[model samples]
Target chain A: MPIKNNNNEIGDSELVDSARHGDTVAFGELIGRHSDKIYNRAFSIMRNREDALDISQEAWIKAWQRLSQFNGRSSFLTWINRITINLCLDCLRRNKRFNAESMDQIDEESGGVERQLPIETPNPTRRLERHELRERIDEALQQISHEHRTVLILHEFEGLEYKEIAEAMECSIGTVMSRLFYARRKMAVLLSGLRQEGY
Target chain B: MIDERKELKIQAYLDGELTIFGRYKVNRLLAHNAEARRLHAELNSIQELLHHNELDHPLPEDKESFRTRITHQLRVEGEGTSRVPNRIRPVLKWVAASAATALIIFAGVYSLMSPENSNQTPAHVLLGGESIEPEAANASFITFKSESAKLSVVWVDTKSSPVASPIN
Candidate 1:
């Protein structure tokens, strides 16, 4: 007797294929697997719970509508991430509060020379309690511009490569590098102060 | 002393973006320069902190609301109903109005330009010696032309109306 793999335990590509054939259950499973990360990315960019939820849902809706066009050039998660990021960018564009100029001015005002103090002193953040680090990082992330913060989240949190970050951001690799550099610098300066404050 | 080229190379090296040859050059610089080594440490620390900071932040409970809203929207749209009721209703109203206006104009022109209405004649008529009266209320003299195979009943009024009736 030959052993058989259960259809319910299908891989992402197979699930995608079934979803393309109009199987809503397969698509629902895909959503269940990725919704958390997608929601987190949206929250990271939008900084609002409601907006993040809306964007993630919209991304999934768009994925379903355009599923036939997905040619598997990238992983399904990546394809969906691109959709979510684009939706977030659209939301940001509409808000006018999240524009690049306003963000840059805010950073300049808050990020003076005093903000550049070093935070880590031979104690790795990994060694810190996980919950405290999460709180600190989340708070620190809110201080950076959306553009810088997005690159950081995609690169550091999501573990996307520079090229993938560039694709998600619709920018050149050099731009991704430059943005990542400035973002890391700003984060270091912010987190360093928080550490010294003993938070 | 940190040269400008070396500083840029150090940043690239920390980012893991340097070519192998470029990394070798920066490594050579690091071997002799204390400042280069410090810069490397600072860069490395930043990367580590950024990577580890947000690893465990669970999304808020309300985050799922967006997904629900979007799914509802997609369902509604996929049903093929109007997304913008106000916008589309006005457009449909305009199209209907324009069609009605065209129909009225066509009916009016057709009534006026039809040959039977102008000639005041039945479509088929036969001829004989018998006298046939005109349908309209007026005195008239009947005239028939055999060469053209035409008949005309001229009303008594100088402002006469043309009529054609069969004589049997």
Candidate 2:
């Protein structure tokens, strides 16, 4: 649906067909339509600007190379998102040794592993302006580790099911659920912290 | 840690990733216990936040530069299918050799650094070195005779790697 840009009169399906035939212009059109979303997804997963840039470009190159293999089973954006997500996952894996041991380390100040921070207000996010809420969410996300954050992005933002997440993460469905659960609880703590900060 | 089974039930109920019976059980539990209700409300608010308030981070402002870089790369790749010009053939081999040499030197330097810093090649190191896309290497017929050397450069695609999560 995002493919119908004013500058590009063609639909995504048409562009994909042309790009499959090696039309650079068609592929460029496709890139123009979806690169930002792909870049955003990369940033969400990688949590670094430069890595997001490299990974996003790499995803495009891969999409261009693998264009013909695309069967139109999913939307073009979905296809690109999958490519970007996989690349992010790959980048994360390649560099996993450099990161923290695990995202499972509970915050010392959070009191315990089963931190259920009381939601003081009825709906804190409702009180926030759109941009302010995003800032708060981004801040909260930065506090979580890659594993937890990745699950949150894949489930909530990308709308992938637990099984799909398990497949992408190469883990069991229960692991996916566990990570999702941990991520949500962590988010609750972070959001409540923001509420306390008067954000 | 909380009761693992009870926590799972609460998350399942909130996610609606459960069967009818599991749903009924959590519903009854939440109705009866004030603590469970509070926990449910806290968890459910996160869902609302993610669903209604999640915002995408902005891309770099100079997006056109990125597009230009990708466009140039695509054009270069398009030209790759054509025959390598005779003049550049020898240069490419020398470059590969130089790359191998440089890789060894860089690896030695990286290997000696503080364990924390040497865990992975960071941003500056990669920036300073020449990069060949793995696809570009795939198109070439070079082979490393040394098993250790080959193993060092082997690409590990994380998609297929075995992932062990804490829950598992």
The candidate that wins on DockQ is 2
- iRMS for all predictions? 5.9, 5.1
Error of 2 at A136 (Å): 0.7
Query: Where does model 1 exceed 4 Å of error?
Result: A1-8, A97-121, A161-167, A170-175, A193-199, B1-8, B52-75, B81-168
* Model 2 per-residue lDDT tens digits across residues B22-108: 999988988887777777777777877778566676668566666777867887887875344333555776776677667656754
Q: DockQ for the candidate 2 complex?
A: 0.19
Q: Distance from true position, residue A160, model 2, in Å?
A: 0.9
Candidate 1 chain B, run of 10 with poorest lDDT: B121-130
Q: TM-score of model 1, chain A?
A: 0.77
Per-residue error at B57 for model 1, in Å? Answer: 5.2
Cα lDDT tens digits for candidate 1, A41-104:
7888888888997787778888987887798999999889878888987787687755655555
